[model samples]
Target: MSPARGGWVILLSVVLAMLLSVVQLPQGTPDWLAWLRPNWLLLVVFYWVMALPHRLGLITAWLIGLFADVLHGEALGVNAFGLAGITYVTWSLYERLRMYTRAQQALLVLVLATLLELVLLAAQLVTLGLSFEWMGLVQTLVTAVMTALFWPPVFLVLRWLRRHLKVV
Candidate 1:
């Protein structure tokens, strides 16, 4: 249960998510399975930040965010700043967050996910001069919903790994 091993798990998950983000699934004229890009990286980082705050702190979050930026071809440091901020906020609330039930945890995740999206949108708007729209909010909301829906499975996986495989 060392932090190093936990970092590896998180790093692998992020990389996998990045690969998944780009894989095109064809169903019609447009690609299928394109909508599942529901902030998988954010979810993974949030999981570790909440579950293993002592191990994966803001620094790790920032680094992974940068990596995500490179992989996604997003503006440089956009994900880095947003993720670092979200991780810091989550880490600040870790003690209280740890006390919540799964349902409550999902709610918190929803809020945090929205925050992450907002931060990304804002950063892009500022740094890249991108125009903001209500759809961005909707997309973020969808991502939040997806993150909430996906939390239980992720939680179960990490819990099992923590118990069986030794991840800090």
Candidate 2:
């Protein structure tokens, strides 16, 4: 499919992921419970970057990352930098990544998701002087694991959408 024809599907998926990224649990939920919220935007961008590097990848991710910054009302460039890092790594290694099975990809997703969280944590520390005493570290790891575990279902669904919608 032409980029013009198929691009809306890609955009729609990204928008949905963005919306999911900000979903808040009910009030009085434990703070640690927040760690269970998968990085929906990260997973979606990873899928698109892996599946169609030539069409929508790094730049798109960076833009979405900027949006993430606004969405979270954080300092500019934090999410942008984190997302750019993910996109660049994925773009560079996508060929090899495509050869791996779903389980293997989930393992790598764990790593990438961890790295993204670390970047965010580092930015927060540098910009706002937070997370110096490992306060967020555990939650970061938990979130990464959650994101990784979510990979299989996210991958299957997006792959199906790509095939059925013929997103190129």
Candidate 3:
């Protein structure tokens, strides 16, 4: 398909990621499984920002983040800021990221996810007056690790779609 026709794939993937990010496991699911949930939107935005740096910019990221905040029922602008900040970093390093091996990319994803989590956590603590707990912190680490673990397969699928659809 032409780039013009295929561009919507980006939007579609992002929407799906947003939905998946908030999707809860079935009833009676273990709490540990919840901690294993990766931030799907973060992974998708990272992929697209890296794959199409020229097309996906900070504004688009901010919009996506705003919607994410709504979806997650967080204080408005909290996730928006985090996503935009991460998106900016990814956009700045797109060339280098593209050249990195999958392992390296996953490592970076871990670091990036950790940073984004910290930002969002800090914001929530401030806005919601939430107390910090060690378990919460541990969950953050688990989430980052889980997100990083998911990076390879997510990268492959998005890469395949980008190539298969001839999306620019």
Candidate 4:
């Protein structure tokens, strides 16, 4: 595929991921259940960075993170910083990431997600001066587990998309 077409396809996927990220849970859902929400944008970004490291890098991640910040109504640059951090790590390790088994990749995803959450929390602490909540750690663990569980399907589907669409 032409680079332009491939770039658009990747951007569309990122946009969809952003939409998924902001989707609201049903009313009256338990708080714990809410904490289990996966960071869809991060998962999608991870896939693209792994799949097409040349095309999707820190800039793509930063842009998506800015959009996520707006979509989720968080402080500007919070998600940008966290997502950029993850993307950088993914890009640096793309070859190794691709070689790993799915299960191993999931563990890496969990670690990356935890780090992302910590970055966001630290940003909140600095910007909003919000006292740290221990519950935030639980939320991070829940999000990590959910991200790990969701990774295989996401990886497969994105792999299919890359193949079928001929995304370079």
Candidate 5:
């Protein structure tokens, strides 16, 4: 039998992720708090790729990252390259990742998100001659913390959507 499909749901999730990537904070928000903002697009892409590897993989991540690069007004392909790495790592380990407990998975997310930040930072340094800031590390830590905190709910919801839509 053929695997089920949920193309529209996947598209909708990706669009929402892109929108979240471009969302602005309130004017009075502190710089530290702003830095705590999670990488929503990365999280969404990770979730979908983990849950549906056969359906979503490197190309989807690269395209989503490209759109995000445009939305964030960053160097084109920065996010694409970073997300492609995430997809590769995730694709390689999807089976083990699925078998992991939530806490273990969150730890993995932390590592992956940190790697993504490092890749982007490295790219920026190469092309823009940007100096490293301690804040960048802090931001990476916060992104991981947020990803860990958010993963359970997001996973549950996506799993529900997949089951409801009969996506294989």
Candidate 6:
């Protein structure tokens, strides 16, 4: 698994994940929980940070975050800062996270996913002076749950792709 090829694999995966994250319609609210949305981009970024930290570092996360901000029409640099900060935390602890079992990693992903959403919320508050909504927090929880639940399959498929394609 050469580093160069690994970079390409990560780039392609991130692109696909970003597309999925941004192109979805809002599902109607459920009686129990309605703010739930899939955090596809966060999951992919988390995976790459843990699996190939050297290739997709904080800069990449920040750039993607900015792109997400543009695509979603949020405040500029709101998601960029959040994603970069989380990426920094993930990268700093990448080695330790890489050693965790799949279940543990999934738990960690949930925590990080929640944190990412919160960071974006805070950024929005500070930048635009937007009123904080409890629904925003609830949405974060939903995102965390969805990210955690879907992580195993995404991780397994990515791991297999990396191993089979000779990507690091």
- Candidate 3 lands at a TM-score of 0.94
Candidate 6 residue lDDT tens string, 35-93: 45568788888888888787787888999999989987778887788778878888998
Q: Write the per-residue lDDT of candidate 5 for residues 34-131, one digit (tens) a residue.
A: 66677777778888888888888788889888988888877999999889888999899999899999888888888888788777767767788878
Task: Kindly list the per-residue Cα lDDT of model 2 for residues 50-163, writing each as its tens digit.
Answer: 998987766778899999999988789989888889999999989999999999999999999999998887787888875476658887888899999999999999999999
Model 1: residue 156 alpha-carbon error in angstroms: 1.0
For this target, which candidate reaches the highest TM-score against the unseen true structure?
Answer: 3
lDDT for 48 in candidate 5 is 82
Q: What lDDT would candidate 1 get against the real structure? A: 0.78
- What's the TM-score of each model vs. the native? 0.84, 0.91, 0.94, 0.90, 0.89, 0.84
For model 6, the run of ten residues with the poorest summed lDDT: 29-38
In Å, residue 62's CA in model 3 sits off its true spot by 0.5
Higher-ranked by TM-score: 3 or 6: 3
State the local distance difference test value for candidate 3. Answer: 0.89
lDDT by residue (1-168, candidate 3, tens digit) is 334557798999999998888787999988777778898889999999999887788999999999999988888898888889889999989999999999999999999999988887788788889899888788788889999999999999999999998778
**Considering only N, C-alpha and C atoms within 3 Å, which residue pairs clash in candidate 3?**
none
Q: Superposing all C-alpha atoms, what RMSD in Å does each candidate have to the true structure?
A: 2.6, 1.8, 1.8, 1.9, 1.8, 2.8
Give the 10-residue window scoring lowest on summed lDDT in candidate 1: 29-38
10 residues in a row with least lDDT, candidate 5: 31-40
Better of 1 and 5 by TM-score: 5
Model 1 TM-score (2 dp): 0.84
Q: Candidate 4, TM-score vs. the true structure?
A: 0.90
Tens digit of per-residue lDDT, candidate 1, span 23-107: 7676574532454456777777777888878887778888888988888777888889888987998899888988999899888
